[model samples]
Target: MPVIDITSDPEALTMTVVAEFDAPVERLWSVYTDPRQLERFWGPPGWPATFALFQLSVGGRALYAMNGPRGEVARGAWEFLAIEEPNRFEVLDTFVNEDGSAIDGMPTMRMTFGFEEAGAGSRMRCVSHFTSAEALEQVIAMGSIEGTRLAMGQLDRVLHDLREYSQGQGTQTEVLSDTQVRITRLVDGPRDLVWRAHTEPELMKKWLLGPDGWTMTECEMPDAAPGPYRYAWAPVDGGEGEPFGFDGEVTLMDAPRRMVSTEHMTGTEYPPTLNDLQLYEEDGATLITMIIMYPDAATRDMVLATGMTDGMEASYARLERELLAV
Candidate 1:
């Protein structure tokens, strides 16, 4: 999807997505409207969704169900707003009842899809508009920032796959892809310094999650291998400020060389991310390569969009400060 000029007030409930497609208007429209086509390339990067049934007519309703990393299903529905083939279309998407009925007291979103000829291919935009800013605020309130980004990120793979398939036939033309977020860092410190910066609760509090109200409550570094280590951080937001937490199983633990941990966010029941941290000597400084693999494409994307690597950058910044202190 291409980026569009949006006039949403973040303080309210806002849902907007802009994407560009390299295919022609007809192909893009077909993929958007057809349930099978959608199922084929449905979802963003890490989170993939399956559309159960679809009918592209006024007052016609459709069902969509998305499966998450831990056997959880997220289902929703949409009613056709306007259906114009190969050009424009709109729909009202809603979270519904068990019998496939719309749920009361829930905000139904209006989504619009537009495909225009952009040079050799097309510029496609999908926008989901909400009724109020409160809806948007509620999502943030519920700590849904990461989940939302993951969902959108999953779309990247869908578009990429769609583009590659069409271009191979010499039929599809201008699919646009966004730049991926990459991380690069130079830690000018000793191996022990870096390890302590990561493992020790005292030092970790400075560079890791923090300790004022947010404290590293528990940490277990690998004793022999990676089997039994867990690092837990909790925010004392309400009572003691323990607002958030991430727990993981140590998959690999080789000091100053590589470390791997499978992490699940505190609020979530299932582990959704695998954290791989590699440390090596480059020139005179220590080089670290960190990779986070999600359970599915959708979850990975959500974390990316929520500035996951940005947190890495911040951690590095703090590491630099701690090094200077020593």
Candidate 2:
């Protein structure tokens, strides 16, 4: 998980929060630019936010309200001062009443959000500058620090689900048949990036590792044609357990579209599984479908019992970060 660090100082008249995410900068920017996504995590625990108006352009306006307990509502408005894609933006925020009117003498803020590339992931830093020390203290006393932290905590999970959805990867598992199981996900980006990430040895080394302290030392896929493909992995520290590896033959191949392969995890007695992959493209996005077929019901159940899906989910999350960065 990424770390969320927040700090505020009345003497400085500012509140700043910083965090890193295992996602692309562009996807992270969507949380601020897209009102629907913004509403999902913009408020604290029980106080859900609702946006009535949102415009992502210079001099544009955003009107939103948060519903609190006992039928109370707090409204706010933001006037965009600057707009930059996947990078930074600035806005002037005003505390307002429920009827879209500003409260007289209420504290206002100038907020700036920054996004940058951090290795394979992205970092976000937000600063809220108040007009005076008294105003800053007032907001802090109103629970802004704790509320903002809670809201950001929810943002992490929201990004995970959104990343999977954008990639056309479904979060739910489907038992297609007694001997088969299917996993599907939607991926944002071009077909070439998706294809390369899925096939190329170096790119696969980046995202295909199941968990921490594990690395794929060797990956060989000389040709997409029906032949040999091998991948070997081991603990980074040369720990005690047995090394894990897989090698298989490509039964069929079609660039940027479909492929069929047979794969088996070594150091185990399980039979080799047949995997069929299909890719669909629509409006700059790709949906990847992977179907795994086992020889018998027992083998399929055994594989599922090993908690492979959890590892797959984490691997796919890493793939999303890689794809977006590309």
Candidate 3:
């Protein structure tokens, strides 16, 4: 579970729920953008939501109903106030009766959704604002917190299934030569965003760190021909030991199309490795291909034995999640 925080402040008339996902922002945003996917996890356990009309634009409306355990239906409507694709949106949400009319004197909450890169994935922050303290208390008494937690849990399952399906259908890898391996995946975002993710330090650190408890402390990418760069990492547990790090030089760069680099790790005995990455548009998605080459078969095998492939797969998965906000 990537979720870290869910806090509310009654005095402020706000309820904020924070969660993270191992998927791109667009993937998570689809929970609201796509009506079919939205219905899958919009309600708590045993209560599924069904949308009648849904849209993702300013002034657009979403009318939906959630069937209760005993088959009673609770209808709701949301009028979108603002929309910034793949990043943030604000909506006015209110409970409505079966006749599709807002319930008189009921609480109408203003909700905001934000998505940002957070350590190998994306963090989603949802804040709901009520008009008064009484209104906020009313919703809390209605079991809003627990219901939200359950809905987010369902969301985690949806993301898991999504990544599995994508891994089975969209990604491919193969051994190209005795010293090289090639990885290809159809990325969900734009080519420029993908290029920025690779070259920008601020974006790189968010997803490049292989797993939890590891942090990239230093990353430098200079703008120059044959750019020089360095990346360093340390364990978050504060264990007493030398930090693991690496440095490299960009051998080639062509904006949103291609890049090549020579990389060397601090503790590895293997010679410097060469990496070539290419990105292009295909069927409205970016097709990314990365070729990693070692000096020799022995060195390649030595690196592979260290579970480098597994680490890369994890990092790339994180990258996919981070790109959702890009």
Clashes per prediction? 34, 6, 3
Give the per-residue lDDT of model 2 (tens digit) for 175-207.
655776766666666777888887898899998
lDDT of 2 at 217: 86
- lDDT computed for candidate 2: 0.78
- Against the true structure, candidate 3 reaches a TM-score of 0.50
> Which parts of model 1 are misplaced by more than 4 Å?
1-7, 10-14, 139-326
Count of backbone collisions in candidate 3: 3
Worst 10 residues of 2 by lDDT: 162-171
Off by over 4 Å in 3: 162-326
TM-score of structure candidate 1 = 0.46
Q: Report how far residue 287 has shifted in candidate 3, in Å.
A: 30
- What TM-score does model 2 achieve against the real structure? 0.50
Looking at model 1, report the run of 10 residues with the lowest lDDT sum.
167-176
**Model 1 lDDT vs. the true structure?**
0.58
